[model samples]
Target chain A: MKHKPRLPQGLLTTGSITLTVLVLFATLPGYASIYTVILLAAIFMYIVLTLSWSIFSGPTGYISLASAAFLGTGIYTSAIFGKMLPLPVVVGIGGLASFCLALLAGALTLRLKGIYFSMFTFGLVELIKHLMLWFEINLTGTRGRFVIVVDHITVYYVMLVLLALTILTAYAIRRSKFGLALQSIGEQEEAAAHTGVNVTLVKVSAFAISAFFVGATGAIMATRWTYIDPYIAFNYLFSFMPVLMAIFGGMGQLYGPIMGATVFAYLEEILITRFPYFYMLFFGIILIVSVLYLPNGLAGLIQGWQKRVWGARYVHP
Target chain B: MSILEAEGITKHFGGLTALSGIGFHVDQGEILGLIGPNGAGKTTLFGLISAALPPDRGVIRFKGEVITGLKPHQVCRRGVARTFQSVKVFPNMSVLANVMVGSFFGRPNTVSAAAAEGESVELLEFVGLSAFAAIPARDLTLANQKMLEVARALATAPELLLLDELMAGLNPTEIGLAMDLVTRIRDRGITVFMIEHVMKAIMCVCERIMVLHHGEKIAEGTPKEIAASKTVVEVYLGESAYA
Candidate 1:
């Protein structure tokens, strides 16, 4: 069958505009009342987290398993700082703290390649969790910390701004020389290095930037929830969920992680309510199926189908 | 005086000596051919000189400054670039993008995108792969892949290029084209140190030749000297064939 390769101009423009509107609407006073607004805010936070994960584990093939450690660092730093200072200042401090933590982690773990790198990151999260637990006396008497009640609108707007920044940064990096170096390193490290790329610097820089975004999102997350405990703040599941979303969308492409987070979040909301006990199992099965049949994730599957349907016309007439 | 000098370079892979007390010099604007049988350490010598691997014992001097033990990128920045026997072009990237990586990272003042793009286009045209510029590198045939490798190495603006088996898999026509390309590369005032098994291509383009047998230098001279050397003939054809 003959097919025409028509670019979906309307759909592309509308989809982008719709996403912007929806994001901005989340900051409105009466978008969906306070409860749904908070839920949407949480979704935005996940979007940032998933995209941050994509910077290293997705396109760069680093496969970090300790994203939660950076997230926790930001959450705890912001929560404690907000208790003593202004919220905006606290968020900035959170980003700095996370950057330092990531620098330390990167220095120690960047030398370990492939699966060893992954395991080192996994151990890092566990170490952070244990340290938080062990140093209970230093962390708000071990019961966790809380921020004084502030306007929820402030939290919403802060997260919105942060999300926008994260997306823009991801897009910029995707098109930059640094991005090409990262992709080359991911595909073949030895080749990239021989080609004059500083493979170590590129990998570490991506990891650090990835940590910055996830950490910033984690800071706002603590404020939005009005509490921060190491258990919930640095939950291993927090790291797993974003990695899953990134894999579910498409790891290497910019928009894939965001799409993955949206679909995964919506699915979680629907299925968790109905099969709360089997929710993790459902996630597991979906991951298995996705990995087996759609290795590039849902976005790639859709792209493949689109090409098959429309690409015929572009061939020799 | 030599532009590049390798003095007493020895490499050991545990108990195995890959290169033993090898010394050679490459004059500026000269094409030096390195020839050997398999496992004779031609590629390893390239690696050691290019800083892809550190030699166990060596002092490499470029422009009268020691460059031994420098990292590959640092060596490249010092005007030394090399290709692998196995082609190592960034497989998933477009041909232009692969060359752009070289221009952007190996050269200064290449941070501007327009300059990088222009230089990359020039390099692709120089290597006769301009028509395949937009194609992914993995799609190129072996000969084109080898050409792309050379093009990418050239993008670094190196003073000396180390090409490993640039004509290994090419047919006679492709070999002729590659030989002409190497000559043009030399004419650009860049020194060429090439490792090749294609005897005709090596003799046709190289001003001097060095021979390695089991990681040791057995012969070094012009092509005629090498072709007449009893040691070179015996090493390649064996004692029975030489007899």
Candidate 2:
């Protein structure tokens, strides 16, 4: 009999920690006050967005500003289908719609590398957002929809499930051969191609998979507002926040963005409450400092320290 | 018999001619050396053969099958593999994981995780990188990094291998070892088509050598014949010899 490959201690430790956190959050709704619950729900939405963005942008080294486009797709998909089908089915359709957009966008934009891809994606979102508005305006002479109200607890639970799914997908992809291919693409696209990675296919599929998570999350979270327009649905804030958080956490590791999201989320909460006028300035400063001094972000430091302790070098040149 | 054949292969980057009607073949299990001056299109030829870039003219046949326009990954799956002129190891991955990426190429029959590990370990050991397998690739010395590249290319289980500048920046000791590795690779039934600036490696290792000048083949012969050629001496050697 062949010996089973031993699981890395790091993976196991991280896995347990994640499970513990998920369980803790699952139970928090019961004991936490309504304000805390609402904040937690928002935080969890950020987590899903961060995870989803990281799924494509992290492993592939593609800076995507199109998360909002997928989010908008989900919002519209949910708005149209929420009353006709069950919540889960509506969310599923929203995810599929986002996947299609991702697939199309990936095919068109992934050929451009580095900043070109970033610019094209940013442009794509703007184009999509405007197209969505133009279509909405032409069809209804107005550009918003009334959504079916879901129970707050149910919405919270659904968001939890989405966060869990995003986490699972990220973990799975990071450890799989597919993730290897994507990582290779990120490191060196031409070399990766020569090394037998299907650069185009991997890039496109990663885009679709990343979009699937954000799409679902957006759809499920839509009921909280009960009315969403292209403005709110395709909010550029959703597009920028995750990219910054992923960068701030670290792009190389799966947990970097999560750490980034948590820290930034809490930091934002404090800053906005205490110094509302200067909060944006502080946020911009943090981003700039992290980009300049800590290019690998917080997780990079933690990973380096861990590696040094274990006698392995940090995984960057 | 020829394992790889390129005929009338031409490439141009805009108006600049990189390779013009370049044609050559690598025999089965032979260490064929390609020597050229800087910008002589030796690396470009490797790129064309490895399918990293498409030829603007002519066809390439690998294992007697037309593979002119195949993408690098597709060509790789068809039993052609290569190393880069500049080391392109996945710096963020573990040393073994870098090799594992190669092992996973071409529909590796490693159905189980253990089997995959075993295969990667074997390739790592072959390239003499087994001891540092747990370390990330970025930490390795320059020599070890080159060896890691060789191991990764070998992991593809290629029938034909294109090694670009494998001996570019190495000491005599490392060059000797690298030459031995190339010989061992050929002995194990892999055809090695290599580009080398090191005359010592070309003279000692290659069974046949082809010289390129300005993207065109200027000479092809045994090492002695190449060494004796008036054109080779004037164009490539130009009064330099290493003991």
Candidate 3:
């Protein structure tokens, strides 16, 4: 017997609300303050990074700390080729460069499990950063390069499109058979392999796909910073922030990381402006408290509240 | 004709030999019981056949084609599937989804999602887990989890199914049910090779039994012949007792 795919309740309302928000975002440059547009663009970047990170790490349980490597690849691509190529072409090439790097790196190191895999990826950022620094010092005789600056409005629009694409990709993957295979791999890798899932291929491909978005985001965001060196481009914060945001948001559902990044980024902005010295202190405290109390993150907390409020009426399928 | 043949199968872990020059052949459409004491390399042999682990020195053939060096997934697609000795269900996935993984990727050809889902449900029903289809697999009892593993293996549509200690943790009633399930599975025309410690269930269900002692095949024959075999009896109930 044939069965229709089941969607969760209130998806229609959520879709409409998202569409309305997108419309507002699309038209924001006309009325909103320049600062607000720039701030929102930063928020969008965080969302893309977190969502992309989750697309691979969330389902497959492969925690990679190589976001900076991919992002740096994009930033460097833009720094080197920004003047030579059109903006779209530069961004595409940046993404493709990271994709290839991830493909190579994934094939080599994806065999390592748990903390070993994570450590290898973490070391990858340092490796790339140092290698780039050495290349600049020896071959190019340059420490850093100035990226061609695009207007704030253009940067905002590009980020928004990338955000939309990342979301769509994440959502599509979460619902597809491929997503099921990823989840199974996370649950039991050996069993998944024995059950006919090509564990290595699925893992390496997912890792590479995730890097593409981070690279693309870095390509666009590079314009915001006119001058960048290896250290600036490959800062480890870009790697850890996505993981933190995803944990805070929850990885169980598609909206979790998005909500986490948006709220977290907005909070960071407000705290930095209000109390620059104490902002990081407060942030650390809040993260610790959330980690301790909210084991499943915001999504799980929301799910619990919904179950209590709606009783048996709410089915979370 | 034998559906699976392993010749000169030897495996070593550093200094310890898991299996030494082991050889066996399982006939097509027969339920063959592999019984041995703890660490006789019964599961190791299964791992070798299913390509979970490679043998250091051996040739394994399925349908007369060497399958020794293939990946686990490749072996599975070539119609050999296995259940783990310790149940390995996808804990967070629903019971039906656990089975659906097999249906979706087990065979050589791609299966439509709807068809896979339907087949999964039917397999779940076959294993009496239809009632728990929506529940996460981890929430099921150990016996039920093993049943889910069986259902999942069956979803792969394997011609040769390797069941490793399927009845180990089962109670007497569950053991009876499991024995019946094995017979039913054999009747479906799939070759069954099982590693089992539960003598009653294994003896009643398997058409032929192979005895292993310290990684060597001590005896191989029908259940009655095995029961009367001197070496097989001595290996299980120490030689001093018969002496």
- i-RMSD per candidate, Å: 4.4, 2.5, 1.4
Q: In model 1, how large is the Cα lDDT of residue B194?
A: 97
DockQ, all models: 0.52, 0.52, 0.79
Which candidate has the top score in TM-score?
A: 3
Please give the CA lDDT of all the candidate structures. Answer: 0.83, 0.86, 0.92
lDDT of 2 by residue, A1-317 (tens): 11224358866997799789889989988898887877777788888899899988887778899989898889888898999999999999989999999999899879998899889888877888889899989987887999999977888888888888888888878768888888888877887787777899999999999999889988888888899888888888989999888888987666788888888888898899999999999989988988998878999888778888876643433
Candidate 2 clash pair list? none
The weakest ten consecutive residues by lDDT in model 3 chain B span B234-243
- Evaluated at residue B107, the lDDT of candidate 3 is 91
Highest DockQ against the true fold, candidate: 3
Q: Candidate 1 or 3, higher lDDT?
A: 3
Off by over 4 Å in 2: A1-20, A270-276, A285-296, A300-317, B106-111, B239-243
> How do the candidates rank by lDDT, highest first?
3, 2, 1
Q: Give a tens-digit lDDT track for model 3, residues B1-243.
A: 999998999999889899999888999999999998898889999999999889999999999999999999999999999999999999988888999999998899999987998999988888889999988899999999999999999999999999999998899999988988988888889999999998888778998999888888888999888877888887773564344
Q: Candidates ranked by TM-score, best first?
A: 3, 2, 1
lDDT tens digits, residues B1-243, model 1?
689998999999999999999998999889999998999999999988888889999799998999997887788878888888888888878888888888888764456777878888999999999999887899999999999988888888899999999998899999999999999999999999999999888888999999998889999999888888888887873565333
Clashes of 3: 0
Identify the superior model by lDDT, candidate 2 or candidate 3. Answer: 3
Candidate that would win on lDDT: 3
